[model samples]
Target: MKKIFFAFIVTLGIFEVHAQKEFQGMAVYESKTSTADMKNQMGKNKEITPEMQKLIEERMKGMFEKIFVLHFDRSSSVYKEEEKLDAMGGQGQGGMRMMSSMMGGGGTFYKNVKDKMYSVDKEFMGKEFLIQDSLPQLQWKMESETKQIGGYTCYKATASKPVNMSDFRNFRPKDQSKEAGKEEKKETEKKTNFMDDFELPKEILITAWYAPEIPINQGPENYWGLPGLILEVSDGKTVILCSKVVMNTKEKATIKAPKTGKTVTQKEYDEIVMKKMEELREMGNGPGGFRGMRMGR
Candidate 1:
């Protein structure tokens, strides 16, 4: 009886130690560059790239859109809730709404990720890779440059992507009005945009910060794989930061994928998305064009 009690206490202690070991940190990102055209009161016809012309025609083929942001830690990962924002007003809403609609309704909201143990070995592109299932299978190397961010020492890393605009496909809304006149349908067709392919950005740079006091490796928004917690990530002009950090808390932490969207490859989706945006722009005015549609009435 004494031996059994001793063994039980030992096992319990092991479980507690494992449970307390978790990596958590906050990340923040700020917009540094955007490629959208920002002009006012221009002529009706403007010559665009052949690529832009193609995007104008493919805008009429889909019913839903979604934007996904990934998050990661060393051992496990969780996809945070995705929300859609209305892009009609030139607002900063990305593809979150269309994705939410495709999932049925609402969005997935989570407090944090909860993985206790993670494998240290993983492979990517035939190379020995860091074992992070929650992050993309891309390469990252540390740079000599260093700086202080959010009060933590950070190192710079760079990642690059070729131009590939294939992940957007939910922007086009088809005509549903059966009793509408033929002229209206014709007009919609004339305003449509189509694309043959999408392009990827030229490069991405990440400047990550790690907290030496925190022993676990984790950070916000699909970033991991450093000796310490990363508090910031950036790609050229785009930057994300961590506003909060928690080492060990008593609350139960659960990490799971959100069910609020349809699954799609990035390439197949962005192609449709870019085209639909162009089509909407070609509508001359906004969705229910009254601001610019009437001349003398």
Candidate 2:
């Protein structure tokens, strides 16, 4: 597996040199993260009402059920949401509607597999940010497994990533007060942090299925550098599957890198997003928490 990992990395460099002869195509990936597992796990929490738990679980389930497009021409590609909303709804309405949009928007993500660099066009609240960083160097262990997706044969590969529960900040209830924050944290810690596995596993498995027929080392998100194009991704709770692939068309793709926004690395962007959610939590808690959902503040 380690040998295959090193070989794939070297192969990416070779593909970069022959980019002029590579195929240019587009793929559509529909992502759906199951809520059943999380819903069952949320049942054990005593601090949250059944109603609030259900709301949280449902919101999370919807967040990942979005559509994304990947336009790749050899070493470079852009992966971004299909439904690019022009305006965030109900901005001054001052309700969960605005906050929901704030928490729900999945930003535009771009990757240059040859350079091993990534840029994400993200909008938090009203502020825009350009998240610039290198792609994660995942050591994927090739498995002697195969699957067929959209008529293309795919091979399986798996790797482990360090788990951080803090990444799911949008799903967390807005902090209303200091006491409320502690109580909220205590409750979440008791039953598992926003889902099962709050105990913090050293690492979580990331499984990817890629089709060698498509020679580009690109995928729906920042996942690339594999021997082929990735079609499916699984992270225990969330699963993103490719439903369609379109190639060799007369369509012009705008796969350019985003330039406008405050510049920040991936880590800095994450910190900014999390901080905004925390502020929203306080806002929601201010006037009796999300229309009587009981923020535990």
Candidate 3:
């Protein structure tokens, strides 16, 4: 069995280069999180209710939605869903509304915000790192510790940023009068910080593991660039793994970069977007109450 496993890994190392290569493997990681409710802002004196806890749990579950085993070679991407999402408006208001409806509004908005607000990628040092295009910042660091998963080795990395639970609040627009509605809409338009509340790995940990023999940057989601193939990844509370790995299959694996958008370096695009977001936030204040949802924030 050990020899069979060894041969399987060796086969994967050689032929998984073609985009079509069917390299089978599993990736894993842990997920931990905290949730806050704006409605509960009434304060600590109020007893915590089971209903609220359920809501929080449901929200947390959604926040950890990407936990799963991913299968792909150099040619495909673990975040194929996101690739498809790019066709849906590039994370703008339209994207948020679509996501909120699919996730079931309320708690869903907060969770979805965190998921799309930022992008996490594996770094040149083989460590998982986070990019806050919203904040236009990038940093990499080692995670908490290592673990053995499904006969593979793994390492952990964490970031020291701040997490804003306030993002959990629902920002839909609310207007009582017809004139008020139009006035409010025009005033709040373009002032929403829909992306600010939903960044992942704010003061969180991430783990990534690669096969020492692969010597290529690759992993699930946006993670890549390790000495070997990454088998598992996680933030302190959420985990995702590659469950089955088939190395060096009959077909070849080919990888390609995304062709959409105004092709710019990640850093350059982030800076421009971050500056734009800040300008929007400063220009106007969005609705104050649970306003009705708008197409763009």
Full ranking by TM-score: 2, 1, 3
Question: What would the TM-score be for candidate 2 when compared with the true structure?
Answer: 0.70
Q: Tell me which of candidates 1 and 2 scores higher on TM-score.
A: 2
Q: For residues 214-255, what per-residue lDDT tens digits would candidate 3 score against the true structure?
A: 544456544554556677655433355555565554553233
lDDT of each: 0.39, 0.66, 0.39
- Summarize candidate 2's per-residue lDDT along 59-130 as a digit string, tens digits: 444355678888888778888777644332423323322332333235667888878998876655566677
Estimate the TM-score for candidate 1: 0.47
TM-score of each: 0.47, 0.70, 0.42
Better of 1 and 2 by lDDT: 2
Off by over 4 Å in 2: 1-22, 41-61, 84-105, 163-166, 169-202, 276-297
Distance from true location, Cα of 6 in model 2, Å: 36
By how many angstroms RMSD does model 2 differ from the true structure?
9.5
Model 3 scores worst on lDDT over the 10 consecutive residues at: 104-113
Range of the 10 consecutive residues with the lowest summed lDDT in candidate 2: 286-295
